[model samples]
Target chain A: MSWLLTLLAPILGGFLYGIERKLTARMQSRKGPPILQPFFDLFKLADKRPMVVHSYHAFMGIIHFVAAWVALSVLFFGGDLLVAIFFHLLSTSLLIVAGYSVKSTYSRLGATRELIAIAALEPILILTAISFYLHTGSFEVSKILTAPTSIFTSVLGFLALLIALPGLLKKSPFDAAEAHQEIVGGVEIEFSGFFYDTVYAAKWLDMLFVFTLVFLFGGSSFVVGGALAVFAFFVVLLADNSTARVRYCDMVRLLYSLAFVLAGANIILGVVL
Target chain B: MKKTIHIPIGSQHISLLEPVRFSFECENETIIKVEADVGYVHRGVELACTTKFKFKQVGYVVARVCGLCAIVHSTCYTLGIEELMGIEVPKRASYLRLIANELDRIHSHLLCLSHTAENAGYEALFMRIMKDRELVMEVQEAMTGNRIQFDYVSIGGVNKDMNSELEGVIRNKLGLLHQKVAEIKELFDNNWSLSLKYKNVGVITKEMAYRSSLLGPIARASGVNFDVRNDSDYLPYSELGFKSITMEGGDIHSRNMVRLFELFESIRLIETALDGMPEGEIAAKVRGTPEGESYMRVEAPRGECFYYLKASKGQYLDRVRIKTPTFGSVPGMIEALKGSNYADVPAIIASFDPCLSCTAR
Candidate 1:
């Protein structure tokens, strides 16, 4: 059961992304590819031999993919919440390094923006994790399920997850790094073939990682988790269709504003209730 | 000892949706110096023109320079050749050319403005402008038989004729478009933050703009009252009494405002030309090709796009030299970026509307 859940998290995340992309295309008034198109894209990319520009870029590629997978696997194991957050941060850090190693100005600027975005949202994420630990008296996901409380108050933590939602999808208004139509893939411009595929899957896995974090706030039930994950995916897709990308400076400013307001509200609620 | 800072902007570049490189030396946020290296465009059609084409074929070759502004390129080149050959285009042909060029201008300017707004973090404004641009594109496709690369202009005149029905459709659409453009203009003018981002940012002095030999809006923004249409009286432009709109401040805001105002000027030119519909043939057949060195200049979407052609006794031309408006403004742009903050780099670049393909070609 544990192994199945671990596999299912990434698979579900990847599947949702494929669906989201198709939905975005439809909203743009074009006939999009099949929902399984990303699977086919992954298969095609994997079949090609991975080419490296510098050996370190390839190393970052491996680290980014593996770290995200390991982070989500930690969630699946019902292990330490702090440990999963660290691994997720590790994956993002690796991506930043990869972006910096490229000679393109677009990639460098994008990496800089990604770093700023992380700075804006990481504090709120830590606060949400602490809120979970305070409510359940454990940092482990397996232990948090037994606490007696309705799903509504837990919605506070989910709102924190929602606040960081744009970062996870990397879609419009927050797509500072890989703005495909704008910067022509930004940090990932130099990435191609199998290495590109790894980064692509890692992106999907990162989405899964955050959605899994959202599901935890809802509870540990598989049915509720799956339903909430679907809900999160649709919300992100809607944003992608409706919004054009905001500049990195604007994105950071918005994130900070929302984080302080929502996270501060949650902190006050913890004091009163 | 002084350390020289080497920064590369693009080569597998993502920003600007095109490949262009800039190496700049900056002390803190102030740029000490800058150099533009633009050779990413690899289409060698001009060299191919020496063998695979005739004087008549030059229009098609010029149009291939860019997909988006193909009609502008073709019309400019054809107009230049026609002028050199002393062939007066029919009245209707000139009017049709003006209509096509102005419509192209609307789409091109809207596209640049939308991208500029997007880069500046103005999502709502960008979408609104882009939607308006789509209306112009739909009109273009309906009239020209293609969305882009209109191929409307030939050696002597235009290929397609605008009938009464097509004219009625375009006129009605233009009325709606004028209202939309007014709304967009109001939106930009009223936005305080947008003014802050643009006003006094990327300041290019009159002396600097002139020294760099800047043309079009970049030059006009600096208060240079020069337009190729006024200089040569090409097409229906001279007949319509086209206004050469300009501004004093040569900053990013002025550049944007000049373009914004020119959008209205273009519409006015089209409306006047369409109402005064001249009756005649759209094209004429050219027999002898005895052309010496002749040059022509026209205002492209960016600014003045120049084409110099030398024709031989036979079918192909001896040589074709192009000076895109973007290339002329490169020195001006680098000069403007001298002391602006690092955050304003993308916006400054967008303001110049540097079409790399045009520059590289």
Candidate 2:
């Protein structure tokens, strides 16, 4: 059952992306694309003529997708949460490298912001894991799932993760890295055709990975996990709709002063109380 | 490695509405120097106005200059032709012209405000404003029988007349628009995220505005009280109670506030005009060809739109020169870009509301 879920992760991610698009459109007071739009986009991107800037750049995109999928697989198969987090980090790092490999200024600027965003976000995820470890007495997802959980015990961690989620998903107020008007999709600018499809699919995997992390906060109860994920999803969507993207420096300042501090406090509380 | 990095935006960019290029020399995210290249959409409009179209037909031709301010272009050109032909447009026609121009101003300002929001990455606000702008659009369509290129203005007077029923329609639509604009104004004033992107981000002082000869909302935001409507008797704006809106700070936020407040003023003017629209023939008789040079100016939605017409009593004019507001405001735009963050470039450009099609044409 775990392996089957692992295999279906990308498909689930696609649906999640589709749903986000539809929800965003509704918030903006317009009739959005169909729920299957992401899949349609994938097929359309796949059908385009493949264009690569260089062998290294093209290769990095494929590796990025694989790393993201592997990260999801680790979580699904109940592997070490730390390993999964690191793999997720690796996936973004690879894309950053690909962005740097190009001559396009927008791509490089995007990659730079993406780097800053992860810097602000990664510590919160790590703290969440540490909080989980304190509760379950293990970092292994397999062990954590078997243990009963309540979000209230690590409520600060959950809130911190909520703060980080918009940055993770590239939503507004935290979406400077992918500000299409300013940087033209940033690191994603140079990618085209099947290469872009790979990057696009990787983004879907990222959605699942983040939401799955939220679900894990619910521990043993899939219903509770699903509910938590849904709740966080709406919060992120609201944030995206109601705010404009901040400057990259402002984003870093906010995530650190607010979110990182909260996450650190959660870890300290977990260790003490 | 160099200390400064060069970035070019435009000629073709996602954020830009028109094809004017801007090259920025930056140290990190701070823009240290700016170079702008305008006139990409040049269609030889002046030449075409002289050679291809007759004096009577040239209003329509110049109306094609910029779709957003189409009526203003035609109005200015028509006024110029009328002055040369010694045609006194009916007082009723002037009142109708004022209403159409104000409606045009409301829609254009909303478009600029929405675009500025979008460039700042507030897509939802952008969408909301665009949806609201449709109110003005419906009113425009009802008034002029067209949505955008309302060739409502002609040589002697307007092409369409207002009736009691149409006056009711105008009042109703603009009434709804007033409420929506108030909500939007509140957002522009109070929204924290919008304030971050807008407040003092692209500041141009009153000195800079006056020195650069900036016009429209861009100038008004800097406290420069120079409005063509207040200075000229081209239309019945004085009788209709039109007052220019201004705000201090000269930043993107101030410009937005100026536009939002101006929308209220525009709505008020239209309402006032409708309440007391003088009854007469919308169109007047055109007797002779335009013989002498007559220069005319109209306050376009962007700013002052000037038309210099030299005719020799023939079908075609000898010379036609159009100076659009965007063309005049380019220097002010460049001035605002310098010393700002690179991330704010798109917002600054959008805030200037530079109509490149009008500039280049």
Candidate 3:
């Protein structure tokens, strides 16, 4: 069952992305595209002839998607939280390299911002994992699930994760890395055809990956996990709608001063009491 | 040591409404040098006005210079010809012209505001403003025949007539639009994150605005206090109680606020004009052909739109020259972009509300 679910992560992520688009449009008072728009996009993208830039650039995109899938699989197979994080980081790193591999200025700029975003966000993910370890007495997801716990015990950590979700998902106010209006989808501008499909699928996978981290807050209870996931999803959607994209410097400053501080405080509290 | 990179926002870019190109020299996302190209959209409309169209038909021809400010173009052209031909425009026609011009300004401002929001990554706010803009659009369609390219102005007078029923429709829609725009104003004024993107991001100081000869909302935001309506007697704006809105911040936020306040002002002007409309003909008979040169300037939504016409009592005019707001404001736009982060480029450009169709006409 775990294997089946882990293999189906991309499909689940695709639907989640489609729902997010629909919800964003409805909030914007627009009759948005259908819920299956992402899938439709995927089909259309896959059908295009692959316009290969360079061998390394195209290879990196496929590897990036594979690495993201592996990261999700590692978590779903009841693996260590730290290893899952490592694979996730690797996926992003590959995409960043692919961005740098291109000569496109927008792609390079997007990569630079994406690197900055990762620097701003990776610390919180590690801290959240450490907070989990401190609470559960184990870094293993399988052990953490069976261990008796609820979201109430680590409310601060939960809040910290919730705050960082927008950055992770590249929503408004923190979406400088992928700001379509300015950099024209940033790193994704240089990608096209089947290679682009891999990158797009990887984005949905990244969404699933981050939400899975949010799901960890539920800890052994399916109801609490699902509810947290749904709530966190809406919170992210609202933040995306109501705010303008901040400058990259402001994004880093805010993530550090707010989400970073909360995550660090949660860790400190875990150690103290 | 400094490492500067070149980035180009081009003639076919996604964010641009018209074809324009900006080549920027950046040192790690801070623009240091800028080169702009605004001529890609030129359709030889000036030359066409002289060669392809007669003096009477030139008003409609110039209207095609820009769809957003079509009335302003036609009005400027017609007023110049009227001055040259010595035609007395009816008071009711002048009032009706004022209302159509103000309505055009309202819709254009709303579009700029919505685009500024979109460029800031606030898609929801963009959509909200666009939805509210439908109110002004409805009133505009009723006033003129079309929604966008409303060909209401002619060589002698306006083509549309104002009635009691139309007046009621305009009043009801503007009232609803006022409330919706107020909510939007509240959001823009108080939304902290939006302020971060808009406030002080694309600043053009008063000195810079003056030095660069900035016009319209961009100039008003910098406290230039130069509105063509206040300077000219072409549109009967004084009788309509016209007042130009200005802000001192001179940033994207200030420009947006100026536009919002101007929306309220435009609504008031339209309502007042409707109330005091004279009971006369909507248009006057076309008299003799235009002779000699006359210059006419009108306050377009973006800024002052100037038209120069020279006629020799012939069917075709001798020459026609158009100066649009966007052309005058480009220097100020470059100045604002010099030291700002590249991320703010779209928002800043949108705030200027560059109408390239007019610029490159």
TM-score of chain A of each: 0.91, 0.98, 0.98
Model 1: lDDT equals 0.77
RMSD of 1: 4.7
Considering only chain B, what TM-score does candidate 2 achieve? Answer: 0.99
Model 3 segments more than 4 A misplaced: none
lDDT (tens digit, per residue) of candidate 2 on A151-269: 87899999999999999999898999999999899999999999999999999999999999999988898788899999999999999999998999999999999988888898898
lDDT of 2 by residue, B1-361 (tens): 8888888898899999989999999888899999999969889999999888777788889999999999999999888888898998998899888888989998999999999999999999999999999988998999899999999998788887878898888888888888999999999899999999999999999999999999988899999998999999999888767778888888899899988888888888888887787887877898988889987898888899999989897898999999999999999888899999999999999998989999999
Alpha carbon deviation, residue A30, candidate 3 (Å): 1.5
Of candidates 2 and 1, the better by lDDT: 2
Task: Give the Cα error of residue A209 in candidate 2, in Å.
Answer: 0.3
What is each predicted model's overall lDDT from 0 to 1? 0.77, 0.91, 0.91
Record all residue pairs in model 2 with backbone atoms less than 3 Å apart, i.e. clashing: none
TM-scores for candidates 1 onward, in order: 0.80, 0.99, 0.99
When 1 and 3 are scored with lDDT, the better candidate is 3
Give the TM-score (vs. native) of candidate 1.
0.80
Q: Report the error of model 2 at residue B42, Å.
A: 0.9
